[model samples]
Target: MSTDDPWRPRLAARARLKFDPVAKQELILFPEAALALNETGAAIVRLCEGARSIDQIVDLLSKNYANADRDALMREVMDFLDTIRVRGLLQ
Candidate 1:
């Protein structure tokens, strides 16, 4: 993906994520401490289940939040993905 592509995430096959039942949250745990996700974050986490691409995530968000601006929503989703990935939340 080009640098201008808003939905590009560092693609990797080994990336894994899990939900903590006791905490009622999702966690992305690598070697260091776990990164906890809230409900909205958990929804985004669930969508990246080694299946959908970042563009699909943006489209899904657009469909769900129809009243929101598509570009803005896409940008927000991309930013969130970047934040989570940088925090060791994604593979």
Candidate 2:
């Protein structure tokens, strides 16, 4: 996590994730809402389902998108995560 990047725990931390292998997609359903995720988002959601921190997510993304600059890559990943969170895609 960067100094400028805010980290907020999921509002409903007890929420769980479900993956639909047949659809090659993932869904994060909270008590109030749910979100359907694509492959990349699903990967991130998978990483986040464990106890790994944001830095770990950034590292994973960096290794996956090797051509990207470290800081910029992390920023983009953080931005995507934030967007999903706001859209109720993350628990």
Candidate 3:
């Protein structure tokens, strides 16, 4: 969410999601650790491929969740991205 590069939300270079056979679930593995992803997070994380911008993501998600409050949805998306970015998940 930088002014210099507003649209692209890139996953950290060392981070990747994989199917954990033992747990029978999806998890994101970063250089530091591994973390499970909920459905919503997986959806959002999959979209953060550095190809789409924040606004683009909002539009797509809003359409997917048409019944939700647009403004609230936007806020939640921003908050989730911010949280993960701070954790070094997103670059």
lDDT scores of the candidates, listed in order: 0.67, 0.67, 0.80
TM-scores of the models, in the order given:
0.65, 0.63, 0.82
- For residues 1-91, what per-residue lDDT tens digits would candidate 3 score against the true structure? 5423465887888888787888877778998799798777777887889989887887888888889887787778888888988888888
Judging by TM-score against the true structure, name the best candidate: 3
Which scores better on lDDT, 1 or 3? 3
Ranking by lDDT: 3, 2, 1
Clash pairs (backbone) in predicted model 2: none
At residue 20, give the lDDT of candidate 3.
85
Pitting candidate 2 against candidate 3, the one with the higher lDDT is: 3
Candidate 2 lDDT over residue span 1-91, tens digit each:
4634445334246456788677767877777766777777666777765455677777887788788798886676677777877766555
Better of 2 and 3 by TM-score: 3
Tens-place lDDT per residue, model 1, 17-68, is 6788899887766564667877666667767765677778778867877898
- Rate residue 53 of model 1 by lDDT: 75
Cα error of candidate 2 at position 89, Å = 6.0
Error of 2 at 72 (Å): 2.9
lDDT of 2 at 73: 67
Off by over 4 Å in 3: 1-7, 21-24
